[model samples]
Target: MSNSSTGEIRIFDVNPALDRAALAEQFSRNRRIQIRDVLTDESARNLHGILARETPWGLAWHAAEDGPHNIRREDLATLSQDERVAIARKLDTAMRGTDYGFTYAQYPMLDAYLKKWSPGSPQDAVLELINDQPFLDLIREVSGIAELVKADAQATLYGPGHFLAQHDDSHVAEGWRLAYVLNLCNTDWRPEWGGYLNFYREDGDIEQGFRPRFNALNLFAVPQRHAVSYVPPFAPPERLAITGWFRDR
Candidate 1:
């Protein structure tokens, strides 16, 4: 199978490349690359729609009073989509800065975290995707990492007032080689709305940042300090994405 999108559930198609030299150079020198339209438009739309309604979210509570307070849902089940989103947004707003605060394990920010899905899990279309060979091939082609054997995927929902503090995805036990976020927001989303993916230098200065570009895949080598900035109250209710890592195992 070519790993292209099916009519029933559209998967993403890699962007057509006339010249891959730039992509290879970016990944090689910077250890990161952000590709637009990683998913087909229809596929992105369908996936976002499914996430908006189908995900069964639960509140993610961190250890400290100023710790993580976003809602998460790991168990997929049948439910009303609109109703769930409403509930998620309501809770997200209620917890912001009042009793709940942003205090990172080592950094600072507020954001929701979703339960991750492993391969072969039921009703998990996201995992069904990372397992596709074409997608793996695409990763290899761009990242220049030939030995990458597996991938992990999870759904992340960032509602208004939610954010992720700066942290490096580096635990020897986890074995994550590269981190990626498949953004599922509207294309017209504005920078002033917040929820940007910010990259930092070792000195703690921001080297660069990325808006939640719809249908885009932002991939970076593991252990880089980065964060998702807070989504302000005026922004849309939900910021959705499928985030995870490509592993060497």
Candidate 2:
């Protein structure tokens, strides 16, 4: 897609052109929808590469008992190989399922990464493109959420052994109306390799599961129970995506 650069920020012109009425109806009916080919081919491929290689990532671990904790990159670098493995084992055991606990890794926040990585990084431009008014307007049209005015975004990398447990993205204080994921993996990404996004019913049964599909945007109404499955050790590729939420101002 063609885009214009203003100062250091690039304004992307790509639009998935989803069926707004159908998408709104689906969200009203089921509270979630997944739309494929969310971006032009070249733009998606370029973003996939930039996010995979350029962003600075941080590890986050969570336990049912302890909540969430972050392992800074410097701290991780100081750990010995065995120490790191031991930590991984602990996280793995804790995050096996809802009955246990969960942990995961994420790249820097789009806003924070922009400020820290350098002036005018491409990652910042991508973030700007997605957060621009046109994109937010599209989300509003599709989801039928007139109140959604702002968005928060971050890149995520799920490598072997990372996972997230089931939890509703409900923080009334945060005004998060809908959660979104822009999957950047190739369509060839395998379901068996794990890293699937799953939504659960009240009884804890899986209502839906989505494999990572390139150029796809998945959106779900807030306060719905969902989780990301663990990335298996044998998975051939890392699961990468940009995820966040649209919020009421």
Candidate 3:
């Protein structure tokens, strides 16, 4: 779909060459697979520009019993230097221990659409594209889950020091059927930079891990053990993506 006022910018066009049967076979064997170059070149570049330059980022984190905080960009800017440091320290402490914790930047796409935030922006266009018939059919074919009727999205950025602790997505009551990450990182992203999507074995070993690759779509059945690996201080500033779950309801 073209979102530009001049009608020249196409924002969410999926690649026409994807092999659905092959992807479905892979998913059937392992319940997860990453499709590279999932979007057309023009579309991917346009979407990346939207994430890197147009979106308003916010802080989303949880440290012990303190919070499952969703602080907007404006609110985040109001914090004192010491307050920012304290929040970082608390996140570090919680993550180091045997407890649930995460710290990352996000722009809730669905929420923004419903709230009329940034109307006509590329973010809203992308969300609408996700729920449109073509994209939904693609997801259904790859997952072999015909019941997936809708999706929710959040634009996420995992800059230096960000991480997500491991947890199984067992929210069955919420109708979550599959989890997807539409990676939008730079093509030059390196392994040492971290920010990998890792799946764990029962013995705590990493069963599999997928690096953040530009324009790649990673899909996995929900209720699985997984986490986003920490991005170290030395890593680059942007590990951007659109992430969320596909639901039956």
TM-score of each: 0.74, 0.86, 0.95
Give the alpha carbon lDDT tens digit for every residue of 148-172 in model 2. 8777787888888778877888886
lDDT of each: 0.66, 0.75, 0.90
Q: Is candidate 1 or candidate 2 better by TM-score?
A: 2
lDDT of 3 by residue, 41-132 (tens): 88888889989999899999998887889888999889999999999889878878887899999999999999998887778888988998
Q: Record all residue pairs in model 2 with backbone atoms less than 3 Å apart, i.e. clashing.
A: none
lDDT over C-alpha atoms for residue 42 of model 1: 76
Runs of candidate 2 exceeding 4 Å displacement: 1-12, 72-74, 82-86, 96-100, 111-117
**Candidate 1 lDDT (Cα, 0 to 1):** 0.66
Q: Return the top candidate by lDDT.
A: 3
lDDT of 3: 0.90
Which portions of model 1 miss their true places by more than 4 Å?
A: 1-7, 17-19, 63-123
Angstrom error of the Cα, residue 121, model 3: value is 1.7
